[model samples]
Target: MKSKITVMLVDDHAVVRAGHRMLLSQYENISVVAETARGEEAYQRYIEIHPGIVVMDINLPGMGGLASIRRIHGRDPYARILAFSVHDEPLYVTRALEAGAKGYVTKSSAPEILVEAIIRLAQGDTFVDPEIAQRMVVQTVTGTDPSSLLATLSAREFDIFRLLVNGRTTREIAEELCLGYKTVANYATQIKSKLNVRTTAEMTCLAYQYGVLNG
Candidate 1:
């Protein structure tokens, strides 16, 4: 008999992980080998398990999922990663793909979609949520880049920027990201300059306009 495809799940919420585990358990050919609640643990877990694929949530507690994907790919360039996000913004999709994720799926998508994505990714194929794919096509056709400023952000900068716009104070962001307050302050300055925004309110407005923040 063929070996089942092994998977590692990374998400901050235990409930979410449990739900996915239960859902995937029904599939005889797919086996969840390990689970982690923090993005920082993902790389180490991947190193240990070397699963067939990693299903990662983008909004993790520490380091975040995008950074985790990059770190895992840094260790194993051929690592298969399927980014799972609550945000359906094209920017999230583009960033996940850029960070070396093989597929992208949203939490709002049907459970079957997640299973299908994992199957395809495990087979070395790229999978994108159909709705996100449609939006990506529309975005390309329009040629208007609402997320242009956002795209300019580096992974760390983007993480800080998101926290800033979400009303996280500089000290709060520093603590959350495990950065020195001065370092986070410096990133904040750079983010504001890069985005040409003056205040957190402006940044929040931009985030909302670009679909970076959900209502």
Candidate 2:
């Protein structure tokens, strides 16, 4: 017998969540148990509902989805999170994976892609959109030259690296991640030492060249 799949929705838009709920309702094999707009609530709901799949958006208004996914996965490594977002850019996709997301699907995808992501998650497989997957493979081989330059960075260092390359100031990253300005500044120093990059602009240039930002 095919067991029904339980899904939890985490998107900031009410109408978008409603639309997903309505669409998933058409499939007898899937159930939408809970929905949340904030990252904190999504984390709470995941624990309470223990849904088979979690469809989340990356750019939540509060706390952010990618960070939430990392926290949730830390608590429950078995949790299945499929990032469904309008941001199909490689940076978004790569960050989601580093943060422990199991699947990545763009919101602009056809309905079948959504269905396929859910099914793949249900079967305990990682899912990435075809375009994203191919890009990742090529980057994995060619991205090593400069991308691996940061191999020694800690998780926090990597976070700082990404934000810096994207032109976020230390003050800005601190505010976004809820850390004190000095705290983020400290992370910047650590990242530079680990990556051997002397300046933020230099790191940004390298990040672009190695497809860390482009991918």
Candidates in order have lDDT scores of: 0.89, 0.82
Which ranges in model 1 have alpha carbons more than 4 Å from their true place? none
lDDT of 1 at 153: 93
lDDT of 1 by residue, 1-215 (tens): 98899999998889999999999999999999999998788888899889999999998876778888988988999999999999988889988988999999999999999999999987889999999899889889998757867889998888888788777889987887789999999999999999998988988988888877631
> Cα RMSD (Å) between model 1 and the true structure?
1.7
Candidate 2, residue 87: Cα displacement in angstroms equals 3.7
> In lDDT terms, which candidate is top?
1
Candidate 2: list runs displaced more than 4 Å.
Answer: 89-91, 141-154, 158-172, 191-215
Across 82-135, the per-residue lDDT of candidate 2 in tens digits comes to 987776656567678888899999888888889889989999999999887887
Cα misplacement distance, residue 149 of candidate 1 (Å)? 2.5
TM-score of each: 0.93, 0.77
Q: In candidate 2, how many Å is residue 144 off?
A: 7.8
Candidate 2 lDDT at 87 equals 65
CA shift at 150, candidate 1, in angstroms?
Answer: 1.4
